[model samples]
Target chain A: MSGTFIGMPAFSPPTLPAFSPPTLPAFPTAAKEAVRNPTLRRNLRYATHTIRAKRAAAVSELDDWAALREAGRQIKDHTLRHLDRYLLQLEESVTAAGGVVHWAADADEANRIVTGLVKATGESEVVKVKSMATQEIGLNEALAAEGIHAYETDLAELIVQLGRDRPSHILVPAIHRNRGEIRDIFTHEMSEWGRPAPEGLSDTPAELAEAARLHLREKFLRAKVGISGANFMVAETGTLAVFESEGNGRMCLTLPETLISVVGIEKLVPTWRDLEVFLQTLPRSSTAERMNPYTSMWTGTTDDDGPRTFHLVLLDNGRTDTLADRVGRQALRCIRCSACLNVCPVYERAGGHAYGSVYPGPIGAILSPQLRGTASDIDASLPYASSLCGACYEVCPVAIDIPEVLVHLRERVVEGGPAVRQGAKVTLRPARGHAAERAAMRAARWTFRHPGALRAGQRLASGTRRLVPRTLPGPGRAWSATRDLPKLPPEPFREWWRRTHRPGGQAPADRQEDQR
Target chain B: MSSRDVILGRVRRALADVPDDDTPYEVAVQRGYRRAHGERSIGETVDLLAENLADYRALVHRTDAARLPGLLARLLAGRGARSVLVPPGLPADWLAGELPTRVADDAELTPHQLDRVDSVITGCAVAIAETGTIVLDAGPDQGRRRITLVPDHHICVVRVPGQVVSSVPEALGRLDPARPLTWISGPSATSDIELDRVEGVHGPRTLEVVLTSED
Candidate 1:
């Protein structure tokens, strides 16, 4: 490859706005750009397509998949319904087992709790398993401010870290990068970290994995502090389960003496037997396997086995607020399988970065707005980021009715209603730019209710059809900008229906032929 | 207010929609999924376990209990393993002294020291047939979790027909939830690179499962 395209921004650190959401543009703007990048689209298409087929086949192996999906849904619903009791039970069980449990209502509190715990350990660096909870809290960023370097051991996460880029996909964070791009990131970025990549690394996957293995081996060997997030936290047994395809999680979880898992409160299930349902579904939904290569489950500190000092941080951030909304609480049931993302048409073309949150795709469309609320442009627009295809709900292991929630959130955004923010209730105003669309919807609702007036209007429009322009003007220009308007029919369909279908009225020629 | 109280209060309030009647755990979830995928004879279950274990790239070997020691010796000699880490409760005859020098599991065996050992031999608490998973619960024969983890290779001897279960639910039934459970399907593998699976990351890259059927 020539040096002509060396400055391609795909591998560079994100140029997003300075502060947290400061630089995140609206979903449409980011998605538009992602749609234009052929490389990103190609990467997303290939990865998503490969996983999607595998997931379908894996799921088909189970004779009772639908039953299992329903069971999963009920179990999560039951857990959420009794979250207060289960959380307390979990805390009690874990504490009884000699593990400390801390609670944080928001990201800052969560980060502070984790940082203080790490400081107590006196470890300057930590190895981390790939967790959406930590990413949501920006724990690494928070720890970095205190002069701590957190090493991400998951191979995709390492690439994102080395490239100094944001994670683009939930599972495969660097899904936007091709093999050649990954090779370049390793060649250029490995030296600054721990171990340098061997000279003249090729684009082969085995070579790339070996480079990451060798590079991260030093970190896993000596690292005293490891951070992770749990896939499921069993309430009755006080067990925390982490399912992973790689052994890196095992290294971080097993090798480290001090392991801190920042788990969301919603991760709890009522009992260990509940795992039977999820373990079967999570692997199939995620990696499309009967089981991931390694699944680590620990309840507090083991005598001579895993982490000696285990701290379970229960992180809320906005989960409580999301849980408050009756319809929106279902987002908490997600297993982070990324099944919805793989099946999402919008996600396939626009990619994950557009969601402007750690979560992306159909789940993100509903989740980001609820977790962060719809006050911002990107968060508000996320509710409108789909074609309502229902592909997401079909593949969701817990059968979260994502389309139902998307429409509900859209109504919340455009109609501006009551919502819970942080921990308090707040009223949201209908976002400013949606006035025209809202007014059009209201007018359509009014006309449909008053049929006589609608017929009169249709007749008037037909009479004046000659004067009507094919293109809309004013507020309607945005709609017509990317699409052509269909021509007005000679007569309204209702009038033709009246002529053809009414018993007293003469049958149309087509109807007469059918009668004959 | 403390973050803990605030979160608990929030959780209580968020769950206000549920009815007052406390639901029992067994009834809340419908466990319609099978304990095992389908009916299989004891011999078939062991065969399925072996088949699934090899599918994930774990090396599967079969031999009668009488010949297991000789087989283990030949296998280690084949690898030229100079040192093998032996758990305290591993059957003494299983090693046969001809394989390599035995580094016994001890309180002083640091991870770095274990790393120097070429292989680890341990017994599994349970093995699942459908998923091809060997669960190590840090039992006497299994030693600590780290012995199997730090070494480059692991040779887990599973007593066929006795230790094998047909499914995950069946396997979990036999395992104590309190103990630290590491359910390993194969050698530590990762799909992190380009979402394509490549085996042999941090965990034992080579996992040799010996299915010893007592004749």
Candidate 2:
């Protein structure tokens, strides 16, 4: 039965290139390169530290932050548990509100639906509002394939697109690029797109922002179609909300005649009232503001205001597969606040590029493996990308225990058990190249079963304590390179225990000596 | 099967682990968060709104119903706005005195035209004190969303202690979800560059909020 389902044309993975380029190296390899770049490290450090301090200050002002965080988590969990019912309700509500609803099972389907929608409108260009879902599906590239241009209107996204770079951070896609780099990108690349940067553009953020404003304003006024990814979709009212710091979102949302929004199915909240919790938590956790500069909420298409024609594409991609894991489903609770990214030590060092997915930092470590499955080298290595520091869990507004999920994913990688892939249940073989670790674990398990063998091994190790090298000879050298191998004692603990204590009830060593 | 059915089927199968007697929505989620953060008087709430709006670099002014027109005139002239977009339902008396070229918001007023207008004036549906947010619901007083968005300067009039709420939750209760809502906290700002915030981006670069009390 499963084979027949997989045989269907629609269920097959699309021929389009993967979201992350296949040539990208695994986490460790990429991270090694990223750490060597001093400029990248400095940029990540400066951005993360500034946001972290402000985030702390902003969160401190909310007295009921714990309650709000718990509520946000519970709401998301409840919504996911009964997502089917809410999705159907959402479809009904949206349709009744004069909007069209389309469902896409994966990225290809989503891109196709959006492309068809844009084509039907006779539009060759569309303005975008920094949507991660669209980025995840590589919608811009897909549209470009069809001879349509998708312009990224967000300042950070504009910089990334102009530089021909992949987004390295969630909130600020160009966080890896400093102001000087941004100025250079703008000065060089602005003309090809539409407007040229003013003569002698400086490196100040304000001036750069003004240049973007002047360049994008003409596009906004002329844009006939706008594509966006909603931050939250309310099932009860079919209301979609987008929270953004810049007015680019507003420009795209309001100026266009036709609006196409591709939203992940997991981005739903059960009721309109549930927004209060997220509205309070997301901004503080994300941009560390009491509220972002703008939040646009529309139930559907209105008669003479905003977009006259609205199309909502509900995208599953790998969300259903992600929801299948009892432990891993918590990743779906993410608000894409990127709070975890800002707080992650590993992310700060490795940078967002190493995660090799649209989502980076600790969240990506757990989410990428589940959504894409740990079949590839990058996916397999993603589980072990973290030190399990648990800072991502600490800053998560939804209270997703990221460390727990990372450890769980690590188990998945090593054990290779029953899992879902592209809506099919498949048994996974243990990831390749873990045979050595597996063998070592099996040997350790054997040694612990027999006390005599364990004692013999311990004695042999202690007898040769002086001869044990400072670092292991071959595979373990890398592990010990930056770490100090502990010095083994002259006597093992078992031998010391046997010599010092009586089997029967007796005070051990120092106490007995004191009594005597 | 349609992709909707396919996706929904997948969702049900994925959630097969959920027991038939799983907790319902009402009890499953605990909403213990406060309706409002701290207790404040109505006057104090309005004051916080003004303070916070200003904190984000929005220009805030206080006046009564009788003086509102004079204040609006002064504000537009001070900004040197050549033309102001007015929602059709905005109170005429508010702009009764000297004003810029009054551009009425109508279907013919395209986004490009709104861009040419120097400023826009509208009345808000609700004002959130904690976040310094003003919500527009395309009400009679508040025109189409684009009018406020396309122009660089926005002068919003808020009824003191009436439209103002202490928190987001309080504001939501008063808002209708069916209508489109645009919540403006401050003039457009961005923190994308090195996470350092700089004001005046795409939206209205200048937002002058007038708090009017009937008196």
lDDT for each candidate structure: 0.87, 0.90
| Top of the candidates by lDDT | 2
TM-score per candidate, chains pooled: 0.94, 0.95
The C-alpha stretches of model 2 lying farther than 4 A from their native spots are A1-21, A502-516, B22-24
lDDT of 2 by residue, A1-516 (tens): 022321112222222333564566889899999999999999999999999999999999998999999999989988998999999999999999988999999999999999999999998779999999999989988987887778899999988888888888999989999999999999987876777899999999999999999999988998999999999999999999999988999999988999999999999998988999999999999999999999999988998998999999999989999999999999999999999999999999999988899988898888888888888888899988888888889999999999999988888888899898878899999977676778778989999998899999989998998898998766666668878999777777777666668475344745445333
Q: Second chain only: TM-score per model?
A: 0.96, 0.97
Candidate 2 C-alpha lDDT tens digits along B96-210: 8799899998887777787899999999999999999999999999999999988899999999988999999999999999999999999999998999999988999998899
User: In model 2, which residue pairs have backbone atoms overlapping below 3 Å?
Assistant: none
- Please list the residue runs of candidate 1 whose C-alpha ends up more than 4 Å from where it truly belongs after superposition: A1-19, A449-452, A466-471, A482-484, A494-516
How high is the lDDT of residue B82 in model 2?
A: 95
Q: What's the residue-level lDDT of A365 in candidate 2?
A: 87
Q: For candidate 1, lDDT tens digit of each residue in A64-113?
A: 89989999999999888888889999999999887999999889999999
How many clashes in each candidate? 1, 0
Candidate 2 chain A: worst 10 consecutive residues by lDDT? A6-15
